[model samples]
Target: MKGVVIIPTYNERENIIPRSGGRRNASQYGIIDAVHKNLPQADVLIVDDASPDGTADVVKQKMKRDPKLHLIEREGKLGLGTAYIRGFGWALEHGYDYAFEMDADFSHDPADLPRFIAEIQKGADLVIGSRYMPGGGVVDWPAKRMILSHYANIYARFGTAAPIKDMTAGFKCYRTEVFKHIRMQEIETDGYGFQIEIDYRVWRAGFRVREIPIIFRDRRMGVSKLNKRIVWQALFLVPRLGLWNLWR
Candidate 1:
């Protein structure tokens, strides 16, 4: 089945390009290269939000060389949720059978991509790269951050009652058909909440959901996009969605 990997980026030029001798040095092969190495048949789509660091320029350069590389440059910094929303629409218009959500940085390992495709081929509609599952964990995070992340997932799980371990995970794949069933226009939250809402809707819609083990690493380069606003949105939105689901 044909698939597209959608990466939403803001100020991720360093991670998209190969650089020398720095803590922020991207992967030796760069994210696009690593993805191509793992899934040569899959196409890569970059949904850049007009980063000041010339991130889109690097993508354009790569696009010139590789026809499989595609880009959607937003006028400004739109939220990650909208970027993926736009990407999902584009994938549907272009006739891709499956779509993937991945980070621009190396936080989500490209090597695990094959496993996701494997699960999808086996008839799973949504495959999550879970960090809370057995054999899956985080690397290079502070104790406080890790604790918060862990409990946040628990809280989200309790709130949404999704049958998966990692509700806030950004690393996942979806059958393009799932989006056709979900009410795309009604999704309001962005950031972490976006992941939860989509997963909850997919499960509620009776799609088969599966989780695979993945060791998530913090970004090796560029600034983190996470903020207090995004976290707070998730905190409040989960219970609301859960309560709303009870009536349905």
Candidate 2:
């Protein structure tokens, strides 16, 4: 399946806007920087949330020169899941075979993208870049935040009963059919919860889900978007999906 990776950015200019790390942020995993570098064959769909720091400006300048990059500017800071949903639909309309979700702040390493694509080639409909698995880890996060994040993924997995290690993981690749049948419009989470919903749906549908180890480095620049509101949404939505799916 021909594929595209959709990254939603709010304010990542400080980290990637520079001339050096630009390559690290652009290139796909395996050898070097993934987001800003060398995936010449794949298209990058960046959905910017109107970041005040001129993140879109950087992408636009890059796009002017790099034919592989594309941008979608939203009016303001919309929810995370909606941005991805919009991107998914756009990818579908464009007839892309595989769709991906990742972060702009480097929290979800761009270098791991090629790994996601490689797993897709192996017949896995949903390939997750998991941090809890072997060789996967977090760097520079406070111990409290790390624990909170670790258990959140754990809680989402247990509550949803997804047969996976990290259900809340945003780094994922989906076959077109996964998006085609999931009834994305009905997915109500709109935030990080939306990610949980998608993971549960894909698992319930019996699609092949595989976990690939990845070292998730904390972003050296830009503010993170995760917050109590997103956490609350995930906590509230997981049980609902779990209970509802129990009867399905």
Those runs of model 1 whose alpha carbons end farther than 4 Å from true positions after fitting are 21-26
> Which 10-residue span in candidate 2 carries the lowest summed lDDT?
24-33
In model 1, the number of clashes is 0
- Which residue runs does candidate 2 get wrong by more than 4 Å? 19-33, 36-38
Q: State in Å the error of residue 35, model 1.
A: 0.3
Candidate 2, residues 120-188, lDDT tens digits: the string is 888999998888888888888889878888888888877888878877678888887788878788886
lDDT of 1 at 143: 89
Error of 1 at 199 (Å): 0.5
TM-score of 1: 0.96
Output the lDDT of residue 191, model 1. 89
lDDT for position 98 in model 1: 96
Local distance difference test, each candidate: 0.92, 0.78
